[model samples]
Target: MGKFDDLPETRRRGLERMEQVYGFDMTDGTGDFFRYTADHLFADIWERPGLSDRDRRLLLIGLLSGSGGADVLGIQVPAALAAGELDAEELREIVIFLSHYAGWPNGARINSIVENAVAQASRPPK
Candidate 1:
């Protein structure tokens, strides 16, 4: 069995959904990092007691927003949505917070990325 099988039923289901929705396959071309994430991050770290998925997503958003990495923000936004942990408005506020410290160019780029992701999320499912 894969590492995802070790989690509780609900968390296992969630991880499978994440793999499908985000195309996050450890056995894909990428190497150890993906395997680590599959075996440890999701199956172990994120499954830890007392931390809700929403809180983790929010903390990630805070870190990403502060760093102002548009590409990461772009990719992670959908994951946030899929996690059902963060929505558009909270993400908007994250951009606003980033703007203060990360500057206009970075913040604006992140905002655009977030907007695009939110738009994609709103699109009718295929």
Candidate 2:
């Protein structure tokens, strides 16, 4: 089972249906959004023409975590962990940065959500 397997049937069907509708020759976790973000978004968009992926990842972590995207950040956190790119302190720092700029309430909310997301991994691993 892959990461998508952990999701419910409804979401699985939804993503799959979207794939079928778009006529993309890909599986549930291999659609354009996922592929583009993982490959192009990271390798190309983040990699830039010269900037490092580390910098890009930090920027992305900040961008996602800072702008009230705890939900999205929650998802990416796992991806970052899977890729061995994120550390606890760094993740905490992203939340801290959000608190400064994105407002404390939003950042705190994200922190709670992030805590839950991190706990999710320890819960059976899907």
Candidate 3:
């Protein structure tokens, strides 16, 4: 097993969750970026005991919201909800709070993304 496989179960679950949410694969033009993300980002950084998954979810939402990274939120918002890292109401609140700091346009877009994710997450699994 490599470093990715050696990760703790919680970290492993996170990696699998990321792949599921993003449709990540080596052949999808991500290649080393995928491997590095699994190995370094999720397996290493996310596995650290300092922060809870909920905290990481909040931080990621803040960063993505401030940076206008809607593409990322497309995957992350629902996944965060699915993983119990965040709830629909909290997501709405985050958008409202970030609007003041990150600008209205950014927060509005993030709100739209979160709304869509909420809808999708509420659907029954196929």
The number of the candidate with the highest TM-score is: 3
Q: Against the true structure, candidate 3 has what lDDT?
A: 0.76
Candidate 3 segments whose C-alpha is farther than 4 A from its true place: 1-30
| lDDT of predicted model 2 | 0.59
Q: Model 3: how far is 46 from its true place, Å?
A: 0.9
Q: For this target, which candidate reaches the highest lDDT against the unseen true structure?
A: 3
Mind giving the per-residue lDDT tens digits that candidate 1 earns over 1-126? 977666656556546645753545533324677656555666567667896767876677667777766667776777777556678888788889878887888888878987887898899999
28-55 per-residue lDDT for model 2 (tens digits): 4556776554444433444346755456
TM-score, candidate 2, is: 0.55
Better of 2 and 3 by TM-score: 3
Candidate 1 similarity to native, TM-score? 0.70
lDDT of 3 at 62: 90
Clash count, candidate 1? 0
Give every collision pair in model 2: none
Taken over the whole model, the C-alpha lDDT of each candidate is 0.70, 0.59, 0.76
- Model 3 CA lDDT for position 88: 93
